[model samples]
Target: MTPLLETRDVGKTFGSVVALRGVSMTVERGGVTCVLGDNGAGKSTLIKILSGVHAPDSGTYLVDGEPVRFGSPREALDRGIATVYQDLAMIPLMSVWRNFFLGSEPPARGPSRALGGFDVATAKRVAREELRRMGIDIRDVDQPVGTLSGGERQSVAIARAVHFGARVLILDEPTSALGVKQAGVVLRYIAQARDRGLGVVFITHNPHHAYPVGDRFLLLNRGAGLGEYGKADIGRDELTSLMAGGAELDELAHELRRTDTPS
Candidate 1:
């Protein structure tokens, strides 16, 4: 089968400042494509392009073998592309069920529909069911989202995307702010999402977080490509070294050695 999403020599620029150049990768269904980069390394730019927030200045962006030029994120969402940012886009004071159906609340039927309201029962039930499917257990659907742990909050976002039938899930630094255990918790959900056949674009600065769940890795530095590799083609140490631009470590070692030497 064809990849769910693919970019060929994709490039983007801000006025005279180039944000990305000649970068490319494929995101297949049931696969996790991890994009690793540091600040100003085009990670944000690439994600914005994928989520339809901005169009690339060069190269092609394809979805399911079709070239699509999405004018807005809503258009991307209509095409089954959902993005969950680092913040998870959740309201702290809202209930789990409320946040689950925040924007796309299910409409009621018959006379209730005439009253123009939501199907609260169905929403709560469905929210409970979906969370359970993702191995998330909430004490009460009425509990405020802020009351949930970081992992649970991220799980809720992932489940919401799944419930809405998102085909490709673009997660922007979902584990960035969490503790080790919490990050692992979120990673499990990401693996689950991949196993369920949704293409996942996981953007992160942590190679440790990305390596375990990532099937393929794409490294970006200074708005350019290092190379995309399958899991077998790379290792944890090498991935980290490359992300740090390889030789800076050697230079630092040399400098330290000189400093240690008697003058």
Candidate 2:
């Protein structure tokens, strides 16, 4: 089957700086594609291009085998591509239901609809249901989102995207800020999202976090791809080594050992 989303030989340049060069990856239904890279590895550039925040100066982007260049995030959303950023774009002080609906609230009926009122009842019910479906347990939808744990907040964002008909979910470093247990919880939710048949793009610097949940891995370094490998073709240790620049690390270790040796 054709991938839900695909990019081929994509590249971007900002002034004299090349943000990405010849990067390619694919997102398939019910699978997670992990983009592993450190800072300035062109991860952000790839995300922007995928989510329509910016266009690549080179190469083709396709959805279901048809080439498409989205003009804005809305266009991407219209195509069932949703991105949950690191900040999550949620209001801390707002109620869970409120944050879930945000700009896309269902209009209240009759006179209330004419008065620009939203269906609070429906929003609350659906938000709770969606969260439950994603295996996210919240005590109450009326409670302030700020009171939730970091993992819960990330799950909420994921659940929100899935609830809104997202076919391909792009998550930007969702586990980077949490403790080990909390990160595990978020990873579980990511697995849940993939099991539910949403193509997931998980961007992170941590290979350990990505390996267990990812079906495919795309390694990036200094705005270029190291390689793209399927889980069958790569092991966890190999993934980690590649992400850390294995040869470079080994050479550095040898140098350090030599320096510490007695004359």
Candidate 3:
């Protein structure tokens, strides 16, 4: 089957600095494609292009086998591509339902728009339904989003994206700031999204977090492609080593080791 989203020879640059070089990958429907990299490994650059925050300098970006060039983030969203950043983009003091409908609130019909700007009842109903679809249970939709745990917040973000006609979901470091148990919750929701036939691009520095949920892994190193591997082609340890720059780290550690001298 053809991938839901694919990038061919994608490259990005700013002034004289190349942030990404020939980065290519695919996000298949109902599958999780984890992009793994350490700091300065071009992960952010690649995702920015994919999420429509930045345009690629040279490449072909395809959505459903049709070529596309997104001029803005809203363009991507309109094409059913949603991005969930690490921040989650929720207002702490706002109710969960309000945050869910923040920018995309349902407009009131007929005249008297001033009296009925947003359909609060519909927002709450949709938010609860979406959360339930993702296996997330909230005691009340009227509570502030800040009251929810990190994992719960991430789940809500995912649910919101899914509800908003998102066919491909890009998650940026979803588990990086959570505890072990919380991270597990986020992973489960990722699986739920995939099960619902949405292509997921999971970005993270942690190999352990990706190995279990990812169907394919794209490794990046120093703003270049390290290569792509399927789950059967790579192990957890190998993924970790590659992300850490492989043999160079081992050699550097060996050279830095201090030998004990007998007195």
Best by TM-score: 2
| Pairs of residues clashing in candidate 3 | none
Candidate 3 overall lDDT versus native: 0.91
**Predicted candidate 2: what Cα RMSD to the true structure?**
0.7
Arranged by lDDT with the best first, the candidates are: 2, 1, 3
Over the stretch 1-263, how does candidate 3's per-residue lDDT look in tens digits? 98999998888999999999888899999999999998899999888888889989998899889988899999998889999999888999999999888888997755745776877777899899889989999899999999999999999999999998999999999999999999999999999999999999999999999999999999988788888899999999999998887799988777667334334
Better of 1 and 3 by TM-score: 1
| Candidate 1 TM-score, true structure as reference | 0.98
Stretches of candidate 1 exceeding 4 Å from the true structure: none
Q: Candidate 3: TM-score?
A: 0.94
Q: For model 2, where is the 10-residue window of minimal lDDT?
A: 219-228
Candidate 3 Cα misplacement greater than 4 A, ranges: 109-114, 258-263
State which candidate, 1 or 3, has the greater lDDT. Answer: 1
**In order, what is each prediction's RMSD in angstroms?**
0.9, 0.7, 1.8
Cα lDDT tens digits, model 1, 22-101, are 99999999999999999989999999999999998889999999988889999999889999998888999999999999
- Residue 242 of model 2 has an lDDT of 97
Top-lDDT structure, candidate number: 2
